[model samples]
Target: MLGTRVSAFLKLSKRDLKYDLPASIVVFLVALPLCLGIAMASGAPLFAGVLTGVIGGIVVASISGSALSVSGPAAGLTVIVLGAIQQLGAYETFLLAVVLAGVIQLVLGVLKAGMIGNYFPSSVILGMLAAIGITIILKQIPLAFGMTETHAFEVEDGGGIAAFTNTIFSSINWGATIICLLSLAVLIFWPSFKKLSKIPAPLIVVILGVALGFAFQGTSFALNPDHFVSIPVVSSFAEFKGLFIFPDFTQIVSKDVWVVAFTIAIIASLETLLSIEAVDKIDPFKRNSPTNRELIAQGIGNMSSGLLGGLPLTSVIVRSSANANSGGRTRQSAILHGIWLLVALLAIPTVINLIPLAGLAAILLHTGFKLAKPALFKQIYKKGLDQFIPFFITVAAVVFTDLLTGVGIGIVVATFYILKANMTNAYQFNIVQKEEADMAVLTLAEEVTFLNKAPIQQKLYNLPKGVKSVVIDGHKSKFIDKDVIDVIKDFEQNALSKGLSIELNDVTYKQKPLNGNFRLKKQKLQKVV
Candidate 1:
């Protein structure tokens, strides 16, 4: 049975490999620059990002059920990792947090806590995507202009907007600028050629960048060495092991370690879940990735990465979208991409370094445009204030602050909208004309909660003294909050004294079944009139 299963698996792998191979190469190329860029942004070792990409691909993909979702070191976690590393004052200590974070995620997956991601409001999620998009553009501006020594990535720590501006003004390399614009143009207009669907724009951009790098060599227009990728060349197995940094177990008892651990776990898991959801939406097959399983895979991936000196890893949308767009059909593409990363880092680091950073910046700039597309903004605006407010605020907050803080702000805004909608839709109080006089009707909605109490109370207290009759009916309500019931009870108890006659009928369906679907449910209330 084992032999037969292995044979069938190999057969399927082979079929997938054919289509996935090309897609994996695209993902690898996209992932390579992002890994290095994010690692630099995070203030960690450059190789840590490559290590993360390798682990995300080989370990995470092997365990994850997501077909086309690619995992890797992400830009979203740059802020978190940077702060944690600075706070801990040591990279090895930070590794302990990454490992602990994996444990937390593992527990969450086992407990099915992955469902927490489902509760995040869509407006906030869209806002997050937009915020990251805008942040990407802002961060890439310096790089695209060849401001290589500006140290703008540190702005995520506490530098804020002013530091980023300083970076742009301080340095400018015209040679890098020329190449960056050329690469951006290719990325922007390359999609018009439908015949080039199989060949990605990023690949072309990189090739053009390498060609530019060589062109500029030993000439008046020669670009600085910093303009190119600076991946450390690992020549042999002996040197490879030296690159890996082990976690400091001694820091495990420190509260900072535990705190940062949970922080990374929550943020990384959230990023992973959001990325998986976004990738699944774009999947041509429309296949659903199991959320809980993805979390577990991510947990293991992070743990493995931490042990081997890597930055945090997650399901990365930029790479996954690149994979899906490149015709990848299965998880093999993701795994193969990781293997490719490992092979490159171990064998051809020098060749990889030939590509220019400006070229990568162009690609990211293009990605930023896609994420913060004008059409997306217009679409959200058309959805009305409820959606736009949170989305816009989230984007603004993320740009001003960091990722987690901005997400918190967006969630708060989103929650406010939820409360607003709930309050508005909870119930209704209207005065209708009757044969003799005006009859006030308090029609309860599907569900009325304590949140609806203030408005409902105000409406009841101002129930025109001239009213002859008032009906407090919840005959159709699925659920009536106790506070609402008490408010109605108090008003009814005083109705007779106020020269009003009140008729109170079924206020809740707590015990009595409705629509032959719900069990017996009813609200208990004593009638005063």
Candidate 2:
């Protein structure tokens, strides 16, 4: 079996080289600016983002079962990373949390917890995503317009709309704003052209920004050096090696570290699982990836990233879709993209430094807009109050508080709705007191749980006075809770005293199975008359 597996992999690699090679380059181009932008958004060293891309592409891709999924630093985690860094007091301390988070992910993979992603309510998940998008947009606004002294998250003196408007208008740098607007234009409209669609818009944005940066040099409109990406420029192998920052292991005992670790592990795992699931749906081969193995790969990738002073990483749908659209058919494309990232980081630091932060900001802004599109709100609202309420609440909570807290609140609200529905739909009770017949019928739903017991009991005891016969039907029920069964038994015992005849329709009981499982016994119609 091992030999056959190896043979098949080798064959796939050889057959897909023509397609994978170009796809790898496209994915590399697509991942480049994103790595720097997400790292900037995360408030980590720019090099950390590149390192994550390298590790995700090379490490995760190597171990992952997914053929086309690409792993890298993602925008979704920027909010968590930013908050954790501030809360932990140091980047090194945050790194320790990242390392521990990876260990947690490894345990989860071993426990086959990949299915946990499916348990999160869809509305809550969508709300979380939309919240992240809004946060990213808010965070990038200052960068996009080249506001130097004012950080996006900072509070101004006498904070209000007037102060914000005055600060923003006064601090706006026309040079950076021009580049940002141009980049946004390309991102929004580039795909409309058939030929230009093949070239990634981000690559074009970077090139345009760099050219404009140089063009404005020595002029009044010249951008500050801080307006561009600032990765360390290393002259020797020793210098390159020294650039990597290690985690402060001494901080391991801090409670904040564990909280940050758990948060990162869960959010990263969820994003990875969701991304891979989406990638599989779009795969031309329609292949299903082993989610457990993907989690294991991501665990290893994140561990390597933490050790190397890199940002947390996950399977990114943006890069994966780019890979697929560019004809990538195997994991080779992802691995090769990592190699390109490493080579660029080592060899072309000068070229990369020329790319403006404003352009990267525009890219992130575009990503944010996609995540929180108005259409998404309309769609969720159309799903009804049960969905929209939780979704809207989650959005508000995340915006006001944090990701984990918001999701918890959303889950609680969603659970309440679920219980309410269960209580109301447990069974259908109807009464017919006509001259021809005075009969009442109680029909059990497909599955009845203990939550249904109260309503069932109340309805059973409150039947109309003129009813001559009462029928309890379970023909459609596959499973009935023991509590509900007890209620039925009690009703049977009291029916005679109420001067009503009792009948059971396809409702029978049997001993619990030998294996200690309780299953509803399906028998012919049983009567208790």
Candidate 3:
């Protein structure tokens, strides 16, 4: 019996691990550099990136709903995390926020809040993604030039336009700068050559950058630890003792921890949802993820990450898309990527350190350009003004403010436009009666939204003074908003007082009526005549 069960489990596992091993290797190669870059961006210890990638792939992938989605340290969370670290005053304290954030995410999953992802307009999502791409390119420029001095931004200088400009001008490492330009050239034109097109340009660029760094090591050019890939020092198993930093339990009493916790939960959930949607669009297999399950997976992964002295993890679009493009067919690629990180970290720290930071920047810059290409903007514009307007607004907001703030602004603008469109053509009402028992009926038009509140209110107010029975028929209406339901509730109250009857028909959950009649069926009228 034991042998039978073991064989069954192995068969299922093998089925899940169907991606070509070569593709998995490519994904791992791509993921390693990004893991370090994102960790650096977040102002966390460099190992934090590797740790996140390992957990996201090995631990999170084991439980995730997405088959091809990859998770790791994300650039999107950099700003919030940096601020949290500064505010919390220590990495350990900040870890407390991460743990609390995990708990909050779990609660959201239990409540099925992942459904919120379905409402985001596709145009807005594309714009936000493009904006993020542009931001990554701009932010990495300084690092590419080997400028590490501008790393610290005082509390007063705020992190938008001014700080970015200062960082650009104040420190520029010429050696790294030249390498970046060369790397960009290779990435752009390498695809034109049929013989080289199949090769990974970024990996090639990294190799060249590393060679250049070695050549310039003792000459006029010198590369500091900050300008090269950082491999955490682990002399032995005992030296790995500091790998996991525990959060201070005392932070639980502080209000600030809760604030950070909620922020992480909300932002993490939003990013995860958006990434899942984007990944599905790119998947050749067209597998739909169970959103609630995804939330739970992220929650568990993040909780584990925090407890293990790592940063928060989320389903990141860039890595997930890369996995898809690299011919990853199943969850095995993600899992293998994590396993690779662990193996590399333990077996080849010295070799990993040989990779130059400029090389990684080159790869990222190429990625950024792809994301923010002019063709994308044109495509979005062609979709129509309703789509274009919200998209542009989201891009501008994200460029000017931080990620959450920018998305919030886009949500508000989109909501306003949506409400405006709904209000203009929202309502028409008709009254009818049946002669069998003098039944009065109210028929609503094809659409009724919260914006139709005024019309619904007026109709109820001017209801016939002598009507003894009334029914609201929404059979023809495709949608009914919450405001109309509130109006119905008010009508129900007044009808009872005036010896009239009331009934509702053809209401639906999708229409979101104000009353708890989400799935309630049409019922016979109660007469008061």
Candidate 4:
């Protein structure tokens, strides 16, 4: 079985090499800055993010059932990681939590809890993707303006609007800003020419920024070292080995550790499921990824990451979407990107450290714009209030609050509309006036439950005195609740006192012997006045 799986994978990789190869390069370029940034934001060692990216790509991609999704240290988990690190009192202790989280995810996958992702409304999911795009744009703005990580941190701590204003007004690197603008221009227009499309725009952006970085050196507009990607350069294998920080197993019994572990597991799993769902929607092939297998893959990746001193990882939409947009056709792109990350980190760290953060920021900025485009908003609005309200509220909530909280709120709103629709559409009522006598027609819907009993009863009890006959039709109903049937029977009894003729069409009650419960069953139409 294992050999067959390997053979199938090799065949797929070979078939899509042309598409996956360049796409992997694009994903690698995109993943680089994000991995570092999420690590910095999480208050962990910068190499931790690179480690997560490597493991997620090589380990998780090999095990996952998804074709295009990529995994890495996610920006969404930064707040939780930062807090967990502080609470645990050491970075090593937090790694223990990450491992425990992986175990929990494995259990969840085994229980088939991945199906929970299917319950999320499409509107809420779309809103979540849009909100993430907006957040990415907001976060990358300072970097695009040639600001330092310190300045970006200030924006994060100070509130997005006020802090962003102060940071941008206080300092600006003209060199980095110029390069960022040039990079954005290249990204915006590069895909327009079909012939040059195979060469990823992000690569050209990096090359342009690197060339400009050299040209502006020693000048007044020169970029500060802080504006460039910073990876610690190691001269020997021993030095590189020294960078790895193992988890502290001594903290395994700590209650705080378990709490952090559960938090990470649930949040990471949710984010991974949501990311894959979004990626599948945009896939040209419209393939359905196996969610349970994805959870298992993520669980193994997180365990390996924690064991080797890396941040927790999840399937990241930013990188995955980039892969898809770049024409990635299979999981090979994700795996290859991880290999590139490992190679770059070990072989030429200095060269990578020289790439300006502004260029990467430009790439992310373009990606963000595509996600939250005005066309998407207009399209959702056209889907009607039922879809638009939940979608809009979800976008607003996610922007103002955290992702999980926002999605939860959106789900509540969507569920409310669903219940409202079910209540209002319980049945169809119409009145007809004939020369001899007026008649009323009441048709039951596909499914009638206890919640619909009040409305159905109300309509029948309030019938006009001039109506001499009433018809209750259940031919279209597949499932009719006992409460609804009781309502109909009581109304018929009430009608007898008013000298009204009543007719029943294809409705009867069936009692279950095991549970002593009853259900409405179809029967021959009958009349009883």
TM-score of 1: 0.87
What TM-score fits each model? 0.87, 0.81, 0.74, 0.92
Candidate 2 has a TM-score of 0.81
Task: Determine which window of 10 residues in candidate 4 has minimal summed lDDT.
Answer: 149-158
Residues 337-435 of candidate 4: C-alpha lDDT, one tens digit per residue: 999999999998999988999999999999888889999999999999999999999999999998889999999999999888888898898889899
Candidate 1, residues 27-137, lDDT tens digits: the string is 898799889888989999999999999999988998888999889898878888999999999999999999999988898889887777777777777777777778888
Strongest candidate by TM-score: 4
Screening candidate 4 with a backbone cut-off below 3 angstroms (N, C-alpha, C), the clashing residue pairs are: none
Q: Write the per-residue lDDT of candidate 3 for residues 1-529, one digit (tens) a residue.
A: 9977854542325654555343466567667878877788888888888888999988877777787888887777888999999998988888888988988888889899889988887766777778877887887776688776655433356778878777665567677777778888887787689897666666678778888888878765667777877678688887777677888878798899889989998888889998888778768989998888888889888888888889998998777866776567777788888988898888888877887777777776776676778998898788778778988999889888877688778878888877876665555545455564455566677767677788667776776655567777777776666667677777878878876667767653243367856553343223333
RMSD of each: 4.9, 4.6, 7.7, 3.4
- Please, what is the whole-model Cα lDDT of each candidate in the order they appear? 0.85, 0.84, 0.77, 0.90
lDDT measured at residue 156 in model 4 versus the true structure, 0 to 100? 51
Off by over 4 Å in 2: 1-46, 67-69, 73-104, 151-164, 245-271, 274-288, 306-312, 316-333, 430-434, 462-466, 508-528
Q: Least lDDT summed over 10 consecutive residues: which range in candidate 1?
A: 509-518
